[model samples]
Target chain A: MSRKKGFWRSSVWSLSLLAVLAGCGSNAASDSNGAAGGTATNAAGSDSEKEPVVLKLTTWNPISQTVVDKFQEKYPYITIEHDKVYDQFREIIRTRIVSKSDMDMLWLFPNQVAEFSKEDVLMDITGSPWLDNYLEAAVKLGTVDGKTYGVPYNSQPIVMFYNKTLFGELGLEIPQTWDELLAVSEQIKGSGTAPMVIGSKDGWATQFITTAQFGLYQHDNPDVFAQVASGEKKWTDPEFSTYFDGMKELADKGYLLENSVGLSYDQVAQVFKEGKAAMWPMGEWGYSENFDADFSAFELGAFPIPVNRGDQPLVTSLVSDNLLVGVSWSKHQEEIKLFMEFVADPEIAKIWSDETKQAVTVKGGTSETYSPLASSLQPLVDASEAQIFPSMTSSIEPVMFPIFQQILLKQDVDTSKLLEQLQAAQNKDI
Target chain B: MKFMNFRNYIMFILPALLIYLLFFAGPIFSGLYYGFTDWNGFSFKADWVGLENFREAFRDPLLLTALKNMLILSVVVIVLQHSFSILLAVLLDQKLKGIVWMRAVIFFPVILNTVVIGYVWSYMYAPMVGFLPKFFDAIGLHGLAALDWLGDPSLAIYAIALVMVWQYTGYSMMIYLAGLQSVSGEIYEAASIDGAGPWNKFWRVTLPLLIPSVIVNTVLSVIGCMKMFEHVFIMTQGGPANSTQTFGIMIYQYAFKTSQMGYGTAMAMILSVMILAVTYVQIKLLSRMEVAN
Candidate 1:
């Protein structure tokens, strides 16, 4: 009886061990399959026996996905994957570029393109026949040291976005000059309607409005300002005070909302939506979401930011937010350029522009169908003489951004203090 | 039988040791090495930068601001969280109806994700739309109270700390409650028999016994607050000027945002050192109090 019991016990233990091994084997296979499945599902253009050419595009905007989807329908053999990452996409792409990883087609702004070109990371696209298609100013923005590094896909001119209802209630006219704009703001403020709302909370939003005011003068003499930045001219020149003091004077006069220092642009936009503010300085795309009936209460209009000392109105715009097809380290250069040319075709451009409600850079597309807000912004686009402004981030020399933020926040920061700080920052090396 | 004993020991300890080696010790050692190189985090190649990254960290203005904010936040959250928690635990220790339900309600915030808690509090602090400020306005206390809780530089850090206190006070309270229950009722009974008042019994008997609990709670609070990152990032992104920026945000921006990977890693190393030093000081002080008690 004892022998039989021991034999049964040994058999039971062996069976359990076999079961455990089987379980472990299956689990390991399942985990491997899970990781493989993720890659397989995301693999582009693997629809049939033929593997399609895959192109990857990265942007912080989700709208890029819509553009990619439209492009993919026309070229079923080519798959476009748009990677949307907020706040971290630029860093990730920069690291990949520096590391020589497979990065194809990035939506880099003009300033960023300039900085990257300086670092020898961007491809020179100047000789491409596609250069004839874009507006000259748009083309110029993408060029650094006379070499084209990217394609201009979209333009967002910093126009004066005003509330028609508030303007009418306050019995005010659209300001045509810097002094007129300030006078109207004062009048509107007297009527207890917030004359202007610029959200300084994000700090960058403040830069947008302040940059536009600076543009009125800067665009007239880009060479002089560019020289100042290059240290050929003093940054403390009185023109610098004229630029900084304009924003300071507005803030000191309480032309902005009481809580302007703390409110975000979204919150400031809400004030306009709620009919609390008379005007907001923003880009053309700011009103894109007003398609919802709830936000249609206010009529939107864009005017060139009132001229300070120039006959022409100049606007600060980044090159349009569009996808640029860069040759990936792994991709065949000829095939990538061919794909980019196909997407830039006028017919395809027409479809994209009509659907997205933004201008397309293709030479022979219809410009008549733009939204009402886009229509008003056309004059600023046509009269836009300047190529690009110094992006506080892209140019590493001066971290002018934080200096700008400090000026906006400290209301009492003296001009001399500002110039000393800017000069010091501007001299710092990357 | 000797071989079987060896196999049993391996079966018991091998998995845990392997996990600890892979997850804990491995990454820390890797991070330390990376701190010395100009590695962009994706490539096989990197340049040796010596102590250049450290030199940059010392010069970064934003890093200094972030360090200051982190230090202030750590001190405020640790002290306030423990004090409120002990008070609540003491109150709940007294026998009362619905005390169990009250305890659960208090503990609810502790179980919540920091991200959710941070966002919900941001809405509550939202100037025009937030209910908190609006409620104050309704009560005719607008001038005295309707400050933009997260927007104003002077007030933003306090707002972040208040949310942290709300979330973790319940956790600290539970620890104190457990410590309270462990103290014998016999001592309290004897004090009552000797005609000692309730306050006198709490001061002489309960307070001394709770010393160990206070030490545990204080140390944990200090460590957790020192490493705070997620809530601050989600709430303000260190905005309105770098007012709410902390050491974690500074390190993350340098590492990821600016592509100064080496510099960022160096900042992170400094932060870890700060946390270690603060924790050591706290433990030393608390241990002294423990010995005295």
Candidate 2:
């Protein structure tokens, strides 16, 4: 009887041990699967090519289902699982990347591309044939250390969208220089309308005026930020402080919308739509079909934010938007490549541009259909000597938002001190 | 026989023990280890930098601002939330018409998700188009209507604290109500017979009996407010010049946004210690009061 009881006890212990081992084994397998570039079922010896693959593409920006459908229709073997993360996108993406999650592709911001490239979380797509179709400058945005990690899908130029009806009523013409812009703003303020509406409460919106000015600055000092990084120049120098001076002048003179610091981006958009402000400084993407439907009551016109004091030609900031990058750990590299190539096609780019109302980066990808405002902005987009604004780069971008917010919010803000702070932040990062 | 029982007990609890060690204890230990290293979120390698992150955190002005904001939020929430909950509990404990519905109505917000509450309050606190502003405008208080509740740095944290109080007062009230109900009728009757007025009876009898509930509520509120993230994140995103940034949001910004996971983890470890110390003192003081009662 004792021997039989001991045998039963040993059997129970063996089964429990096996159970625990199985649990641990499964976890290890799943973890290794991500690092080893294999799917869960691939461990079972199935041919990966014959198996239908679902590639997970995560983005924070809006994407069209039509584009996804078209991509899927062309490649029947691959399915794109579009995951949209609305809030805390960068944080989520960072966590996902760190964990070696099964993310096939991602839409990265320029700074994110720069930061992620340093960690080798993104695939180097240098010398890809499809990249030849994009504008060289746009393609250069995703390149760091002479290797491309992302492909720019759209070019967003920060332009001033003026209330045409309001300008007409006030007999104001498009400002061609900084002095003329200030005069127009003063006149608009005199006419009992807010000169400009900026959603400074959302820190990112504070970049519009500064970025526009920096574009003109960069036109002269193309290597200004690089110099700052190398300790040859300071952010407090007139080259950078001049931009803040212009932005501060607008705030100090009461030319901005009342309580502009309190208004959110969406609220400011609505205020501009209601003709409460004379000009709304935003990216060209703001002139979408939804904006058209809501803002149909009044006509709108676009102009580059004039940043020159004299006869210096106008230049506006062009930022690369909707950058598609391949995850380094993705098992479906070929499928991700195919998808990227498909997007690089001019026809596909045109469809995306039309759907998003943003300019595509692909050569010959200009949409045939354009709104009147977009049409008016196209010449500026085409002819303006635009560059990625200095503050938009990865090293200096983080401090820009808070410093710009301080400029807008604090009446007696020490511009020199704020610039010093920016320099200090850049120094720390370096 | 005892050894056999012991073996059976170990066999039964081994699975649970392994799970707890793996999931709960494992992360905490790893986090503690990471706190001493310089682990950017992207890189797998973490170099040891003993006491450096903590030293830097002390000098970080933004961390100081976040700490200040967190303390102010905690004090405001603890005082106001407890006072209002105790008041509501006392009132609802009285014999009143439709009291059940009133209790349910009051408790409804407690059941709602924090994110839902945050978004709803964001709409309510929005400047022009929000319900509060419109209501104030309708009541002819245009000045109040024009106040930017979430955007103004001075007012944003307080506004979020108010939302926290609104969502959680009902939960605290429920606990107080339970404490109130557990008290025998004879105690109140005896106080009444001793010629004690309503105020005296509440102070001497009801309030003393509610000491346990107050302790529970205070500890929970302190911990919850210390870790406040959702409302501030969803509403202002610590904006308008980092006015509403809390310690939790600061950690998140460093850990994920800036890729300084080690520094963020160090700050989190400091916050955890602070919370533990504060909670310990609170419980000790409250428990003494309970013992006195």
Candidate 3:
């Protein structure tokens, strides 16, 4: 009995020590990785004899692995390691950063620029030479407090994607106002086609419509949010009331797709691209991403969401999707900077543009099959008729997003109460 | 022998003690401590914010709604999932044609991964090309055709719950089957000799004997449904107007999306206490269900 107890005690101590050792061993491995990465990467600055370096990049979205290989070929010493973390990127990445994980770079949404830049987590790269290569608006998105913490990757806009062939067949012109848009939807429904194709099953998809209005009105009244903040203007006031009323009118008249709430985004896009729907309200990238020649023989065009303000320039909702950010305390800042410069290169930007069918923010980057409707998108930006949405009040969006879905679910919702909730949430965040 | 008894007990428990200290106790205590601080999930550090996060949570309409949802899921799953599972298990226990196949079919969904089940159900619940709407339409139920299973707030949570029931009913059934098998066949023979009907035999003999299974199933489902995340995360993501929001989803939303780590941890701590209290109450209440075999 004494021998057996002794053996068990010995085993317990040894096993626990082994677990401790295993944890320490992992830390040691990462330390070694950080060391190797630092030396070879910093050596790149002098452009002299160098050793192999690994640059770790974490992204929530897919970027072609081949693109990393291409970058490696250009800089033989630096090896690019990409980690694709989906669904739980925010949680995982925040934890990683806090635990001092040695990731060289990461992708971020535009709204995160301010959140991260406020901390020591993100390195300031305001002087990156490649910043000049991107459009001013795109560059502006990666800036917080006049400091550039990220480099712009891509921009997309929410718009009305209409089938040109179907429009011609129905003798319909692009609607200039909210009433016209609804009248056209009713007409399209009368002609036995789904009028407006949307998938409200995903609340985010429904918010595209709401977000579009938010953007359009911001272009007209930039102080609207400030007014609400000061309690001088309610959301039930003209700015939002008109938008909500127009939306409710559409729902009341059955101008929406018959089974919109049951369809997924991809499925509804498929229906619209196949010319089964008269108008598909989607992101500008929809034409490039969702249009399949096998499903339709029609040409597609785009227009902005009409705010029904006669003679006011129509505001298109534009948003910068991906911004490349670097860790502030990385030893290989030079190497991280080099990688960002390469990604901002028009050649690399063009490759991303061609693959994802999304617009690259780099000025010289161009895709072969760019839509003519998207061609004048720059002029709209210059005219101040383009608004970067979801960024207007990103602090409040987390609280308001669910309410947006609720408004869609119950059309008769009291807008005053909803605005009060918004006001309360905004105050709490403040 | 007396001298070695102390050593033997210590040796036996040391490994488990170490594991419990490192994994379970470490996280729970750390989370509880952080609940008093204002940690923004990431950054330099946290500051003390005692009782503030808890106060905020109590006032939060969304969190309250999520708590309500947790209770609804708990009650529905405990009652419906276990009773239905026991009934099916009893029927399957009888020697019938294709009994093995029926058991296999019922238990098959349990073995499949949550993601596969979630995605498959998501497609089935979809309209037009999906199965549910088509079946309803074929049956001449025009109103039921194209029912927005996951979209309408009034119906979305129940729809999600039905999927949960489908996935877990087999699990409870297997437990009941095991309990049913444990009962002596001689007892049934004795009941037959007493001139008892099938229903009477089941009620008087089988039910009392099956109390253990009922207790386990009820406890398991109550806790499982309270911690429900995967299917709800994949299917609706607590959407179609926050109708399907649960404490688990709220924790993720606050911790990650909103980046309020301290508050999220506080919410998690509150949720842990709630689960503990509920489970204890449940076990005590369900202990009355057990009968001496």
The most accurate candidate by DockQ is: 3
lDDT of 2 by residue, A267-300 (tens): 7787788788889888776666337555576888
Query: Which candidate's lDDT is highest?
Result: 2
Task: Give the fraction of native contacts in model 2.
Answer: 0.42
Clashing pairs in 3: none
How many clashing pairs in candidate 2? 0
Model 1 has an lDDT value of 0.67
Q: After superposition, how far is residue B95 of candidate 1 from its true place, in Å?
A: 5.5
CA deviation > 4 Å runs, candidate 2: A1-51, A226-233, A289-294, A370-372, A389-398
Better of 1 and 2 by TM-score: 2
Comparing 1 and 2 on lDDT, the stronger one: 2
Give a tens-digit lDDT track for model 1, residues B37-154.
9875444467888888888778877776776777787778878887888889989998999999999999999888888887778667766666787788889898635587777778
Clash count for candidate 3 is: 0
Which of the predicted structures, 1 or 3, would earn the higher DockQ when compared with the native?
3
Best-fitting candidate, scored by TM-score:
2
User: TM-score of predicted model 3?
Assistant: 0.89
lDDT of 3 at B6: 79
Q: lDDT per residue, candidate 3, A122-168, as tens digits?
A: 87898778899987767777777788888658777777877777778
How displaced is residue B205 in candidate 2, in Å?
Answer: 1.2
lDDT of 3 by residue, B163-184 (tens): 9899999999999999999999
Q: Please provide the root mean square deviation of candidate 3 (C-alpha atoms, Å).
A: 3.8
